[model samples]
Structure formats: structure tokens, C-alpha cells
Target: MSDSLSEAWDFLTQAAAEQDDGCRIPGRSWVPPILEDLVLAARNTSLSRYYPFTSHARLRFSTGPESWIGNGDDLAVGIALVPEGRYLVCTQASHDAPVFVRLETADADEAAAMAEHLVNAGS
Candidate 1:
């Protein structure tokens, strides 16, 4: 893994360790393999190459009363990256939720292109 990717993984593992409460917290094992592959795909994109912090992101684990769209009281794991601006890659930690990315004021077209690349790579 690249240095940035390794740093991201370290941050995630640290977060998991610190936030371990008795409940099911998502650690490295909880992350789906495809999500990591998607992250790798995102890192290799030209758009990511321009940003120094593309893969150097923070990982968060939330388990509270915060209302989620589809997840109710389930653990949430989110990877927040500041590429052009800020984008979040999130999924329910314990549930079979689909991993999705939310971009802020960054390049929407670039995000779309990256998603397309991920899909193509998967196929």
C-alpha cells in the first residue's frame, strides 16, 4: 500500500481501538474488501493525484442516536477525505449497507468519473 493508504489504514485501526465499547465496532476486519479496492481505485485516479491528501484521511466510528437515512442505531464507519474539498465514504458498520461517497464543494464530475472507474474496475 502507498504511504497515504497505509496512514489511512492506521487511522482506521486506531479509531477502532479507541472506540471499542462492547458493541460491534467496525475494524479492519469489518471493512469489506471491495470498499478497500474502491479506495485504492480512488487513490490512483488523476483527480486524486493532484491532491496531496487524497488517501490521507480520517476514519470515524459513530454509534449513537444520530438519525441516519437507512441505518437505525447501527454502528457507522466513515472515511473522510479532503481532496479538492471534503468527501465522505461511509457505510453501516454492522449492517449490510452499501458503501457510498458524499462529496462537498469539490468536483462533482471528478467524483462521478471516479465512480465510473470503480464500476468498470469491478467488472
Candidate 2:
């Protein structure tokens, strides 16, 4: 970790320690498991529900390049942090052999790109 990152962590720790829980409550942080870059880059990612029962918001890392997991049953999305500072996040309607595309993409538009790469990579 860089000095900046460590400093940021320290600041967050201090703030969290001194903060008051007046209106909203905090939940456990979600950390991903270790995996190869390609494996993580190719996963079906999405904003995991923050708490136990809500879909009101999403985590940005979940929308960028990070590893996420799901049962391939519900609506989903995935993100892969690009080496060049860019990123890729994709979605699929189903988890069948070839995840059906509700959307399509190559690499430019990161807004709503689905898993079009899966056709060549899913094997």
C-alpha cells in the first residue's frame, strides 16, 4: 500500500471511531477473494446488496474492474479494472451455457456494456 492509501485508511479509521450513528447505520465491509486477473475480469459482477434487503444504491468498485460473484440466477453485472486506468463491467440475463445478451459492447462504452466477450471467453 502506498503512503496515501495508508493515510486514507488511517483517516477513515479515526473518523469511523469518532463518528456518531444518528440516522443511518453501517454494515460489514465486503471484501473480494483473491483470483487471477483474467478470472476476476471475466466474472459476472454487480453491486452486491449492501445490507441484507435493499437495492437502493451500488458500490462504484462493483461498477468498475473488481471480482464479484452470484448464483447466475438474478439480474447481474461484473467489472474488471483495466491496466491502463480504464475498466470493463458487463452483465448477462441468464447464466446458461452462453449468457444471453440483454446488451452488447466491445470496450469503449462502459455505461451499459454486457458480456459480449463471453462468447469467445466463456469456453
Candidate 3:
């Protein structure tokens, strides 16, 4: 992995480990392999030359009866890689939720095209 990607992974792993709620930490095993591959592929694209990429882990929290409410306690953990502010590969997991990786785009076709490009770029 590139230095930036490695650093981001390390930072997120450390942060997750420090969380009081162990269930909120997605853990390395929860991260899909495609995420790392996508980030590396993005580095080879022209977009990376103009805009820097960043990776982060997002923790959801709820304070009220509703899950969406603003709360200080963690509910789940999600991680994402933003490549040049254009493409996003992310996943979320919790003790009570299923883990699924997603590539965000305008539509399914767009997402498929981007995924193809990233895969080709890596090859």
C-alpha cells in the first residue's frame, strides 16, 4: 500500500481500538479487500494528480430513541476512501447489522463504469 493509505489504515485501526464500545469497531477483518485495491487504483488515475485522496473511519452514534438522533455513544463503525472527491468506496458494520461494501456514484451504471476503470487502472 502507498504511504498515505497505510497511514490512514493505521490511524483508523488505532482509533477504533481505543473506542469504549468494542462492538462499534469494525475491525480489520470487517474491511473488504476491494477498498484497499480501489484506493491504490485511484492513485494511478489523473484525478489523484489534481486532488489528494483521504481515508477515514466514521462512527455512528444515537442519543435518543431514534437511531438517527445525535448521541454521544457509538452505534456502529463505517470506513470510507474518498478519491479526489469524486469516487467513494465505503462500508458499515455493527453487532446487529450486516457488513456491506459500497461504491457511491450517480447510479448503478456509473458505479459499474467507475469500478471497471479502477480495476483496469490497477491492472
Best by lDDT: 1
Q: How many residue pairs clash in each candidate?
A: 0, 5, 0
Candidate 1 structure quality by residue, lDDT tens digits, 1-123: 233534544444444344333213345333222223334444454323221222234433222222244322332334454433344544443446666654332443444354444433531
Better of 1 and 2 by lDDT: 1
lDDT at 117 for candidate 2? 39
Candidate 3 TM-score to native: 0.26
Report clash pairs, candidate 3.
Answer: none
Expressed as tens digits, the lDDT of each residue in 1-123 for candidate 3 is 233534544443354444324433466344333333333344344323222223343222222222333322332222242322233433334445665555564232343345445433541
Model 2 lDDT at residue 57: 21
Of candidates 3 and 2, the better by lDDT: 3
**By summed lDDT, which 10 consecutive residues of candidate 1 come out lowest?**
47-56
Which candidate should be chosen as best, given TM-score against the real structure? 3
Runs in model 2 with CA error above 4 Å?
1-75, 95-123
Clashes of 1: 0
Candidate 2 lDDT tens digits, 1-123: 222423433443343333322212334322112112222222233222211111212112222221234312233544433334333454444445343223323343433224323322541
